[model samples]
Target: MAGQDDERGHDERGQDDERGEGDERGQGASAPATWRRFARERVAQRRFAARQLAELRGYAGRGLVAGTVAVHLVAGLAPVAFMLGTGLALRDLGSDAAIGWLALAAGAFLVQQLVAPVQLVLSRRVQRRVDAACIERLATFSLRGASLAGLERPEVADRLSQADEAFEQWTLTPGAAVEGALALTARYTQLVGSLVVLTWAAGPWAALAGALVAIIARLGQTEAFHRWGDVIRSLAPLRRRANYVRELATGTRAAKEIRTLGLVDWLDDRYVAENRAVLDTLWTRRRAVYGAPFVAYTVAALIGSVIGLLVVARADVDVAAVSVAVQALILCGRFGVIFPESDVKLVYGRGAWQALLELEDIARRTGPEPAAAAPGARLTPQRSVRLDDVRFGYTTDRAVLDGLDLDLPVGTSTALIGVNGAGKTTLVKLLTGMYTPQSGAVRIDGEDLRTLDVDAWQAAFAITFQDYLRYELPLRENVAMAAIAHRDDDEGIRAELERVGLGSLLAELPDGLDTPLTRALPGGRDLSGGQWQRLALARALFAVRHGASVLVLDEPTAQLDARGEAEFYDTFLELTRGVTSLVISHRFSTVRRADRIVVLDGGRVTEAGTHDELVATGGQYARMFDVQARRFADEAGAGSPDEPDDPFDHSAAAGAGATGGAR
Candidate 1:
């Protein structure tokens, strides 16, 4: 069975390869310089980021970011070079060479115009690729070895939120911002060249004064941005609240209950309040970051204009030299604004980059793919499933299950019954190997479940939990999804649907098998709660009909009417006739039919016996049965009495018919 499972695993991998569904490598730098830092404490984290990014980049491909920057720089420089050439040409207006220089500059500007569109298209693709890489890694890491318990932790929730859509911003706004920085650099380059030309035309002191004003303004902006980063981080709550409001209003799961409860006013008011909070935070932070820079820019502009006039008043300067100095002054003034904004942008980019690094590090350490469990652990189980001296807790102070021991024999049907919060579901999770016991062993066959190949072992069972997924897909696909190998088998899919009493319903639909089962989509219709539950059962049964030998039906008839529930119980028993079955339910009528019944209370088994034996003992099982039986009897007696059957007569008739004689 292990070798066959491996072959199937190999085939599944080959299919994933064909479908291009696996995780792509990250695209981060790996040079020692990229990871190196003066702060020794940050070295390990930086190295992690470098490696994650490198892995991401490998899958995303290297050319997107670098190519986009290279193209943007080229596009930015073309226009600036054109303007400089034009200025120099005007300074030599009478020369033939001036016309040629102006013509070359015109051509360069046109080339820049042509390349801009192409660069935009290419950059957008890269952004999409980067976002794709982040999502792929999250899936791989989250599913690899991370337990569901870990995801339920508050710290994990925060880290997941931090990493979730944060990296997406880099692909959306930051890429363009980085491009803007490159454009700013190109403008600075043009300003420097223009000043040099003006210096040759005029005096060097004029250029010196202009450069000082630009540098001071730019440096002041950088200082202000440091304050902005702290403000934004502090404002995370308002931002998170605003996002929560949007989610509540838009999420599909929330929509049904919200509308049914008439919570439009309450939700809308909450959204409005959150929106207001977001605006308030933005206003406060923006004011703090930009207020001082606004004053600094105004003062610097006045100083720069004064410097220009002093240089212009000198008698040594010619009119042409003065004209060139004025042009240089205009360009330098523009540079003052551009350079400072770029400094602010650069600071913002670095902060976001650092946040991405931190998120990546957290994801890598706890990601789905940790080193495959210990070596030589093949995940194959030999004996029946066993939980030995197991202890577990949902929280530190509240233990849910304590020192429980049980062994489920292979190829036998066992029923578990308990009140709510009795750890019935938790026991199932342990047996199925979703959660490991805090201090004991859950073994499958004879092998420890923890050491078994989790994926392979889990693939062996067909389970129908009380809260199974009602997939918004066609009826056929919903059931077929249970048996992945039979997903495309139309006849088999339909047969499973029919077995669950959905044949008439499927045929009545507009497109028969092709009709979608969701109201959210065009031409799709929704099913009732009971109907969806039937579909969920069909999904489980389909898996059993294929190769799943271990079948778990967890409250399969929860939503059915009394008659339907009885019929379903009989059908389920027939379905799992020869397989190992573990049934969980609160209804003793349905569970009493199992080959063996186990009663759990406060996480420990209080009784284990057949229905007749348990009832004869007059224990907890008998009390529960009496409570239910009396309720059914009262309901029957209060109105129209239910038809009662004569068990002895039916048995006598069957016995006489089998003997070919009537007594």
Candidate 2:
């Protein structure tokens, strides 16, 4: 055993020698590397701190912030002074001079107590405002830029998550951190005074042990927390699922379906299961975070006990001096605990702040969409809107649209046809400037879409999507959302609703146009699915009435029955006549009346032309139409006469001019 121990020591020494030689050779490289790391860390800290201070300024005026600082300073310094005065008063109680020390001690304590209430009030107010102001600004910034590509980025998404969590609820905001920073001043003051007194009364070695314990405990906790970072990150998906389940159990939109489908108990069970999983994840990591600190504290307590024994054994120690030593050592131990807690708070809070700060920096780069035109830029499309050599995808691994090109002629009803996953919806977003392409030009008339003002660009078109929102607002507001610029046009709202065949819905409303649209609101009523679709149509037509020249209806009649869909298709031309309408429909019957039809396959234009032209070509479009026609015939009966190949019974003007479905 002795030989093995000696050999092990020798081996360690040899390894140390090798490391020493490597270190000496790399000393020049190592110094600069270490300094660079330190410099980067310091710079990051300074920058983040400055940002926090700047954010704080937005919530607190200069005078109030100054006053907060003053109170904090007074409170921080008071502790050490009071401790000194208390020690003196205790030691010199028999002397007249003790009265002065007692007075000083009493005054210091009283002053700190008096300032605390004001400091707390200011801190609370700052916390409220800072959280609100910071979250709102982040939201505004997040909603900017023409493309959603930034939000899709992993780094930006993570930052937004951090900021959102912080805003939701926090153990410490920037104001709390600031106040805690000042509290740190007080803790350190107590720490130093205790060390000075302990050293003078007992010995320096006792002070050293206290300091060592404090360092070890803080380092242990901080390291443990960081070590769990990867685990926390790994739980993101689980956390998201948990959050979804929680919302599902409580959300208003899902309430109807949950009750109808008997999903209430199932939803509650899922929510409970997810919450348990989340709890388990957090609980599993608790030991790693707490073990080291607990061990260090135990060691500190043992060392303190030894110090007390040594002081008692020394016959030369005066009783008054011994008391002072005990008091000081107690303060040292208290500081050891307090400092570690402060360090823990600093680590997690700073990390959260850094994430937000990093997001802000990233937003500065490749952001704010520089090509957005001035507010007054023309919105009316005079000629046509063109997607010029456009390419885009949600992720790098898969390209949704590859070199896709198309045109929408001014005042022409063009139908876009495609199978699922053909990048149809992506095209609509690109045209609307909700997403900017990785490379391409969406041109309006002659101007590139990127360079067009976002507001004006959106103003150019009125769109009703497959998943249109049913806003729980007043009936008027539901329609007025489209004509925001002319919301006060009550008569206009009534006319638009009438145009969409919803005049009957309005008459039945308890308060007519002023009636609320959701039962969630007082005296409100929800609309049926068909009624909601008509309402969405009303919103779109309202936009057209208020100067929107282009109309986009993506699966606009999805909720309507067969009769309603056929009826809508019959009148679709009259309803959108003279408007440059781009319609997307899975039901071939509805879009067969469009002036031109373009077929999309795997994100490229496979065919284009009139319905007749496409059918004559006998390509992808003709094959699709034939399949639908056969189905209708088969359903009616095999003995029945074959139905027309055309989906709609409209006149030749609507069906004759389709360009072609495939090349």
Which residue segments of model 2 deviate by more than 4 Å? 1-64, 94-96, 153-159, 170-179, 189-234, 255-277, 297-325, 338-351, 358-378, 395-398, 511-514, 562-578, 630-663
lDDT of 1 by residue, 96-153 (tens): 9789878878988888888778776765565456556555655665676466666555
Question: What TM-score goes with each of the models?
Answer: 0.78, 0.79
Per-residue lDDT of 1-663 in model 2, one digit per residue for the tens?
Answer: 112233334446556655765675577557766555545544543454545545555565666666766776677667756776777787788999899988998999998899778877876665566556666656666765414656666666666676676556675444445445444555665567666776676677666755554454444444455445435645655776798788788888688899999998888888989989988977877675566656765676667556554653472556655766666656655543535424544444544554565565565454445354565343888889899888988878888888888999998999988888898889998888877788887899879876767767886788999899999889989998877767789999998888777888899999988899998889899999988998998899898887888999998877776655665677788878889999998767766789999998876788999988998999988898776665554544543355444435453222222212311
Compare the candidates by lDDT and give the number of the best one.
Answer: 2
**Clash count, one per candidate:** 19, 11
The deviation in Å at residue 128 for candidate 2 is 3.3
Worst 10-residue lDDT window for candidate 2 reads 654-663
